[model samples]
Target: MQEILNLEPQNIWKNFYDLNQVPRPSKKEEKVIKFMMDFGKKLNLETIKDSVGNVIIKKPASAGMEDRKTIVLQSHLDMVCQKNNDVQFDFDTQGIEMYVDTDGFVKAKGTTLGADNGIGVATIMTVLESQDMVHPPIEALFTIDEETGMTGAIGLDETILQGEILLNLDTEEDDELTMGCAGGLDVTATKSYSVENLSGDFKSLKVDIKGLKGGHSGGDIHLGLGNSNKILGRFLHESLNFNAQISSMNSGSLRNAIPREGHFVISTPTANFDELKSALENLKKDILIEFQNVEPNIQISVSDVELATNVASQDETKNLAFALMTAYNGVYRMSPEIAGLTETSNNVANVVVGDGEMKILCLTRSALDSNKKNLSETLKATFELCGFEVSFSGGYPGWRPNTNSEILRLMEKLYKEMFGEEPKISATHGGLECGIIGGHYPNLDMVSFGPNIFGAHSPDERVEIKSVQKFWKFFVDVLKNTPKK
Candidate 1:
C-alpha cells in the first residue's frame, strides 16, 4: 500500500489507501460515510450528508477562476465486494488487501481491488485538497450503493448541487470518454415445490461448475464469456436423461456480476448412476470445447456425497433446469449506430434452490427505453412460460449523449492537445450514475472517463498504474480549462 502512495499522483493514491482501510460494500457504507464526513470537516470544506448517505463537499474557486462555472466531480462510494471462494475474508469486517504486481497493475489479494470507483473517489479527494491547482468552484459528490443499486443517485436532492458540469469518474477506459450508458433492471423468478422423501435406493453426488471468468454483467457481456448459471442449467437439463432429481442448488451471489460458479446436489437411482456419470463427462467435454479460448479453466465435475432424505420433486427440478437453460444470458442486440457496441443484453446472474422453493435472478440492460422494456418483458415472458413467478426491481434509467455540449468540446480539444491523438468517444453497456443524476438535473452537462481498469466486479479486478498518471494529467488540465459561464 505504501508503494501506491509513492506513485506519481501521491494525493490520489494516498486517499485511495485511506478508502481501502474502511469497508464500503454496496448498501453497507456507514463507516465510509463517517470517514468522508471527517475528511471534509478536517479540510474545512462545507460538507453535507443527505438522508440517503450521499456526501457532498464544496470548495471555492482558486484565484482568478471565481467566475468559472461550478463543476461537480462525481463518483460512488460503494464497491462490488467479490472474492475467491477459498479466501476467507468478510467484506463488512475487513479492508481490502492491495498490492502492486510486477507488471505495474494494482490488484487485491484474492479479492476485488475496488478500483472501479475507489480511484474515482480518490481523484475527487485529491482535487479538493489541491491548493496550487487552478479550478472552478468544485463540488465532490460521492454517492452510495451504486454497485448493487442506485439508491444514492435515486434519493439524491437535486437542489444541493449548483454545478452545471458533472465529470463522472467511474468509466474504465483511459482513452475513451463515455457519453451514454445502458439502463438496467433485475428480474427474479420463483417456484414452489413439495419436498419429497427418498423412497428408493439412490446415489447422491455434488456437481460443481467452476473456474469461469465471471465479470461485470454489462461490460463483459460482449466478450461472450461463459456464464456459470447457464452452464449449470445445461448440465442439469442434460442429466435429466439419466433420471436425476435435484436436492438443492446454489450459484452466483450478485445480480450485476456474471456468475462464475454453480453448485448442485442431486440424487439418481443406483441403476442410473453409471449412465449419469458418463453423460456428465461427455457434457463437460462439450462445454469445455465451446468455451475453450475464453474460459480455458472451465471445470465441471461430480463427486460423491451423502444422500439427503428430502429432495425437490422431479417435475419441479425439471422445470427449474429447463427454465434456466431457456433464459437469456448474453448480448441480445448490437447497436446499429455504433460498430461493435452492445445495444442490449441480459445476465442470468444467480440461482438458488432450497426447501420447497427455487429462485432464478437475471438482469437486463439497454440504452433505449423501449428496448429496455422489451428486454424486461422478454425475460418475464420466458420465465412465466417456464412455470415461475417473475418480478422486476431496482430499475434505473440510461444517460443520453450530448455531442454538441461545451464540456465535450473542451475535453475533446484539451485531450487531443495533451496526448497528440484524439480520444475515442463512445458509450458503455454498463450502468453509470450519470443517467440517474442527469434525470434530476435536466440541463446537466456530463461526461464520464477514467483510468484503465479490468475485471471489475470480480476478484480479478486490477488497475493500470501508468494510466492513472496520464488520467490525472488530463483531469487537472480539463479543470484548468473549464470555460467561463
Candidate 2:
C-alpha cells in the first residue's frame, strides 16, 4: 500500500488503494457509504445522506475563492462484482485483493478492480480534505447501485443540489470528454415445452466455450469480442444435425457484460458419437481462426454426462437454437450524427434452462430514445415470432448533449491550456447517471472524464497509472479556473 502511495498519481491512487480495502458491490454499499459519511463529518463538511443511501458533502470555497462558481463532482459508490470461477471472494463481506501489474496498471486479483467510479469517489474526497488546494464551492455526490441499476440517481431530489455545473468522473478514456451517453433497457424472453424421452444407445456430453475477453456492453460493443453464450448457441445449433439433444444449458452471469464462458449438456447416439466429436474439432478450428486476434484461447470442449430422463422435443430444441441465434446482439447501428460512434447495441448476457422453461435475458442500449424504442420492439417481435413470451423493463432515458453548455466551453479551454491540445469530445454508447441527473436538474451543465480503464465489468479490468495523474491535474485545473456566468 505504501508503494502504491509513492506512485506518481498520488491523491486518487492513494484513495483508490484505501477504497479497495472495503467491499462495496452493487446493492451492498452500506459500509462504504458509512466510511465516506464519517470522513466528511471528521472534516467538518456539511454532509447529507438521502433515504436511498446517496451521500452529498458540501465544502465551502477556500479562502479568497468564496465568490467562485459552485460545481458538483459525482460518482457511484457501488462496483460491478465479478471474479474468476476459481477465485472465492464474497462481495458482501470481503475486500478486494489488489496489486500493481508489471505494466504499471493497478488491478484486482481475478476480480473487478472497482476503478470505474471508486477513483471518482476518492478524488472528490481528497480534493475536499486538501487544505492547501484552491478551488470553488464544491459538492461531492456519491450514489449507490449504479451497476445493477441507477436507483440512487433516479430517486435523487433536485432541491438537494444547488450546483449549476456537474462533472461526472466515471468516463473510461483519459483523452476523451464524454458529453452524452446512451439509454438502456432489459428484455427477458421465456419458452416452455414438454420433455420427451431419448431412444436408442446414447452418449451424454458437456460442451463449453471459454477464455474470451468479455467487456462492458456499451463501451466494448464495437470491439467484436465474442459473447460466449452467442458462440455456444451457434455451435450447438449447427451440431444439432448430428442428432444431438440438449438436456440443459447455462452461460454468463451479468447482464451488462459480454459473456466470457458458457456450458451445455447434450446427448447423441453412441454409434454417431465419434462423428460428432470430429465435427466439434472442425468447428473449433474454424472458430479459433475466425476470432484469433480478438478472442484467442476461445475453446469448445465436450465430456461425458449422465443422460437426462427426458429432453425437449426435437422441434422445441430447434426453435430454441434458432431464437438464440436470431436474437440481435452486438452493434445494431452507428451514429448518424457522430461519425464512428455506435448509436445502438445489445448483449445476450444470460441464459438458463430448468423445468421445461428456458429464460434468456438481454440488455439493449441506444443514445436516442426513439432508437432505443425501435430496437426493443424489434427484439420483442423476434421473441414473439419464435413462440416465446417476451417482456421488457428497467428502461432509462439518454442524456442529450448541450453543445452550447457554458461548462463544456470552460472545460474545453482549460483542457487545451493544460495539455496543449484539444481533448477528444465524444458520447458514450453505455448508460450513465448524467441522463438521470440531467432530468432532475434541467438547467445543469454536465460532462464526464476519467483515466484510461480497460475491460470494465469483467475480471480483466484495470486502470492506467499515468492516465490517472493527467486526469487529476486536469480536474484540479478545471475546478480552479472555470468561472460562473
Candidate 3:
C-alpha cells in the first residue's frame, strides 16, 4: 500500500492501487461494484446500483458552486481479462499482478494491466473523494461489461442521471480529446462439406505464421501491422496454385484483436512436398521484408506431420481460402468529414476448422450506423460470393459528435487553461459507453479523454504514470469551471 502512495498526488494513486487489488474482469465485477458502493456510502454520497449491476455515485457541488451545470464522469468498471499462456491467474478470483516498469509504466505481470478503463475509474474515484475540490454537481457512472459488450450502458435508465453533460475517461492517448467513436458488429461464417480420404501418396506439413504484434484492429489498423490469419490465407492461396491441400486451420482467440499467430496443416503429394517447403521459405522472406517495419520477426515455417485421412476436399479448401482472402479486414474507409480518421474497419478475429466446415468470425466497426450496416453487408456479400454462409450479430450504434456542446466547450477551455495548450479533439476507432449512453439520454453532451495507454486488450498493456497526473489535473479543472445553465 505504501508503494501505491509513492506514485503521485497520493490519493489518486492510492485508489488506483486499491482498484488493482480487486478482480473485476468483464461481466465478473461484483466485488469491485460492492467496494465502490461501500466507498460511496462512506463518503456520504448518493449511491445507486441498477438491476444490471451498473453503479452511479452522486456528489453535490462544492461550496458556492451548487448552481453550476451538472456533469457526469463515466468509465467502465470491468477490464478485458487476457494474459500470457504461461501465466496462471484467474480473472474470476485473483487480483491483477501490478508492478511499476522501468519506463515508469504501470503494468500487470503476464496479464493485461487494465489501464484502458481502470485508470479512468481511479481518476473518477479520486475526484469523488476529494474534499477540497471545487466543482459542479458530479455523477460518477461505473458501467459493467464494457469489454465484452456495452451491456450496462445499453440497459441504463436515462432518468437516473441528472447530468446533461458526460465526460468519458476511456480514450487511450493523453493529449487527444475523442469526440466520437465507431459502432461495431460481429459476423460469423459457417459452412459444411464432406471430408474424404486422400488416395494419393502425400506428406503432411504444418505451416505456421507467428511473432507478429497484433494490436486492436481498429486503433492500429492504419499502422500496417501484420494479421497472421490473413498472411496464412495468402500463403494457402498461393499454395493452391501448386495444388496443396489443407487439413486444418486455426488462428486468433478474441473477436476484437488482430491475430498474432496462426497455423494450418496441409497435405501435399510426396513429389510436391519439396516445392511447398521451398515456396514457404521464399514467402517468409518476402513477408518479412514487406512488413519489416511493423512485424520484423514474422515467420512462416513448414514441418512434417503424421498424414491424416480426414481432410476437406480440394474444392472446399479453395473456397475457404478464397473467402478468407477476400473477406474484409482492417480499415474499410476513412471519414471524409474528419481528415485522417478511420470511418470503418473490420477485425477477422477467429478462424476454426471443423470436421466438414470452417468457421470464420469477424468484428466490424463504424462511427456511422449506415456505414456499419454497409460494411457488414459488404463482408457478408464477400463470403456469399465466395460460396459460404454468413451471419452477423452483436451490433451496436456509434456516439455521434455534438459540436455545439456546452460541456465540450467548457472542458476545452479548462484543458487549455490547465495545460497552456489546446487539446487534440478527434474521434476514436474503438467503441465506448457514450454511444449507448446517448441512446438512453438523447440530450446528453458527451466527450472522452484519458491518459496515455498502450497495447490495450493485450498482455503488453500499460499506463503512463506521468500522463495520469496531467489527466487528473485537467479533469479537476473541468469540474471546477463547468458552465452554469
Query: Model 3: per-residue lDDT, tens digit, 121-221?
Result: 98889889888999889999999988777889988977899897898999998888888888889888888888877887888888887767776767877
- Quantify all predictions' global Cα lDDT against the true fold: 0.91, 0.86, 0.84
User: What local lDDT does model 1 show for residue 268?
Assistant: 87
Which number leads on TM-score? 1
Q: What lDDT is reached at residue 20 by model 3?
A: 82
User: What does candidate 1 score on TM?
Assistant: 0.99
- Which of the two candidates, 2 or 3, achieves a greater TM-score against the reference? 2
Whose TM-score is higher: candidate 1's or candidate 3's? 1
Ranking by lDDT: 1, 2, 3
The most accurate candidate by lDDT is 1
Write one digit per residue (lDDT tens) for candidate 2, span 136-158.
Answer: 89989999988777899998977
Cα RMSDs, all models = 0.9, 1.7, 2.2
Please identify which of the two predictions, 1 or 2, would achieve the higher TM-score against the true structure: 1
List candidate 1 stretches off by more than 4 Å: none
lDDT by residue for model 1 over 52-170, one digit each (tens)? 99999999999999999999999999999988888999999899999889998999999999998999999999988877999999999999999987999999997999999999999
Lowest lDDT 10-residue stretch of candidate 2: 308-317
